[model samples]
Target: MTAVPQERRIVTAIPGPKSQELQARRLSTVAGGVGSVLPVFTARAGGGIIEDIDGNRMIDFGSGIAVTSVGASAEAVVRRASAQLADFTHTCFMVTPYEGYVEVCEALAELTPGDHAKKSALFNSGAEAVENAVKIARSYTKRQAVVVFDHGYHGRTNLTMALTSKNMPYKQGFGPFAPEVYRVPVAYGYRWPTGAENCGPEAAAQAIDQISKQIGAENVAAIIIEPVLGEGGFIEPAKGFLPAIVKFANDNGIVFVADEIQSGFCRTGQWFACEDEGIVPDLITTAKGIAGGLPLAAVTGRAEMMDSVHGGGLGGTYGGNPVACAGALGSIETMKELDLNAAAKKIESIMKTRLTAMQEKYDIIGDIRGRGAMIAIELVKDPVSKTPFPEAAGALAKACHAEGVLVLTCGTYGNVLRFLPPIVIGEDLLNEGLDVIEAAFAGI
Candidate 1:
């Protein structure tokens, strides 16, 4: 197979003739609700490049929303998944158990934090895994309430939309959402009223206080949070915040669920982000990077909690499709073989060095945060005021896209420009992408 060259080659204007034609066709056939960051349509993608239908190769900095960390066309993933697909595409685990499903669960049990005996249930999407985690937590604790944090993103399903913090794109017009879901404050350092240093302890105290007075701890089944928030702009809660919340959950017998869907599987320089704070959650939800772009997700937690749900209580027809399980196993293998964790750390070091330098030069860049390859720059109207400058972010992204660099903008205020470059990306390509970003900022 011809691998996609790790080079940026802009042969046509962003959405070139072919891509424009496809976009026109897509507008007529695809749902209006589905949005894309760039106007160009992809023809092939591999390594750190996405080749558009018009033959323009752009540097990939989004990783398909961090789902293709092991690379879109990892050799191991392709080999294993292809082999499994050739053998058989489906044999629903619920119908006739398969080794691949059991193997994936075993991997989750071993890889996820905590030494205690663990169990996992597979699903088809991040939202599904989160929904099931809540089910298990509620069943185990016999509670009716769940607590989440501000600026946290879980997923798009009804229950997840309720769990998610943003409104316009994710939760708008989707209510009435699931009941008994409460949102509390997060240790958002940049915008915290008290300042970044005090954000951790104060935010945790306030969040726990709200739970105690507003929603009785005894009634709360789970407190789910992204160790490093994803669509909520990759906000890693202030230090000590997660630990304090974990302690409160332990004290109250509530399940502490770390939703590591976006920050897990070595994306943050470690197998999981919670490990950075030495947090061992009672339950954890994972997806995205787990299956090398295949549709797979999982909820892994303490054995007793997972076993609390009665048999036949949880499952779906295509939950752990054998092919997806194979892909996940292969993805894990590739992660280990390539030592992608170290690669992610290197990317983090390079990005921080460059972004911090950019922050100094640009009054619009208010903050630079995130870990490993999952880094971001929050744009502001001006550093002195620190007012969110979403318009600047939009213009910057468009300029980069026009120059053959693919980036993504997120955050509740839509002012954060996030980068999730594949760990396998070469130093030269990574720096080139950053140069494009820097040039865009200069124009601002």
Candidate 2:
């Protein structure tokens, strides 16, 4: 087999010759509401590089927003998906079910961390998985209220919009959101209002207390949270917060739901982020990287909790499409064979070393934090004051892109630069991308 190239190849401007033509066509044919992060239209992708329509190749650090942990086009995933296509495509899992679905579910049940019996239900998107998990919690607990944390992003669905904390794009004109949903403060250490150096546990306790007093835990269906807040700036909760919340939920009859959509499948150097705390949630919602670029999301949890909703209530028209299931199976196989968990750790090691050096060199870098491959660098006008610099972050990102490196900016204030490189990325390519980031900051 031939080895893959690591560094980026920029033949023309970002939206290169062919991509410019496609962009014009896309404006005419595709919906105007559809947004794009980068202008380069991808013609091919493999390992960790995306080949643009005009022959410009770039190292893909976003992994399609953490959806391709195995790689862009892992050989095993393509082979399995192609083989499954030869057999069948969509039987509409609800109408006629298939073995691939059951097999995938079985794998989920086995892989999900728990010695207790578990079950899984598949869906088409992370939003769908989150919504279904809420439904299951409400059905199982017979409660009317759902509690979510501030800066948490569940999805774009009505219920998930209610769960999400951001307001500008996801919820601008989409409301009225689903009813009986409440928002609480997340344990963000850097910019917390409490002013404690490490106030995650204290903040979580306060939020739990407030909810208990207002909503009454007995009437609360579930408390949904992302183990590591993804779109809200890759904020990982302080050490004691997760365990405290899990204990509170278990004791108070609230379903502890872990939205691992962005942090699962070894993205955080573990199967799930909750595993870092040794906490097993009642319901775990996952997607993004599960199917190696295919759209497949799942809610796996304690058997009793997962089975609470009646059989017909938990499915979608194309929930567990066979092709997606095959892709998922292949993805899981690739993770194991490639030892992605170890790879994630390696990514973290490299990122921490490089980012820490950058922080020392740049006063704009306020904080450097994250687990494994899921890392972020927060930007601020003054490191000591920690005032977010949204414009600086955006400028830095554009500068990196102009230099042929594709990077992403996130956080509620849009002041954090996150790195979600494919676990299969080569060390040299990863370092090169990091160098571009350093150069961008240096120029700024």
Q: Top model by lDDT, which number?
A: 1
Per-residue lDDT value at 378 in model 1: 94
Local accuracy of candidate 1 as per-residue lDDT tens digits, 1-444: 689999999998998999999999999999999999987988899889999999999999999999999889999999999999999999888889989999999999989998999999999999999999999999999998999999999989999999999998998887999999999999999999979999999999999999999999989999999999999888989999999999999999999999999999999999999999999999999999999999999999999999999999999999999999999999999999999999999999999999999988888889999999999999999887889999998999999999999999999999999999988889999999999999998987
**lDDT of each candidate versus the true structure:** 0.94, 0.89
lDDT of 2 at 233: 94
Q: What's the count of clashing pairs in each model shown?
A: 0, 0
Query: Model 1, 46: alpha-carbon shift in Å?
Result: 0.6
**Which residues of candidate 2, in runs, are more than 4 Å off?**
1-4, 193-198
Q: Could you tell me which 10 consecutive residues in candidate 1 have the lowest summed lDDT?
A: 379-388
Per-residue lDDT tens digits for candidate 2, residues 65-145, read 999898878888888898999999988988887999999899988888778899999999999999999999999999989
Spell out the clash pairs found in candidate 2. Answer: none
Q: Each prediction's Cα RMSD?
A: 0.7, 1.3
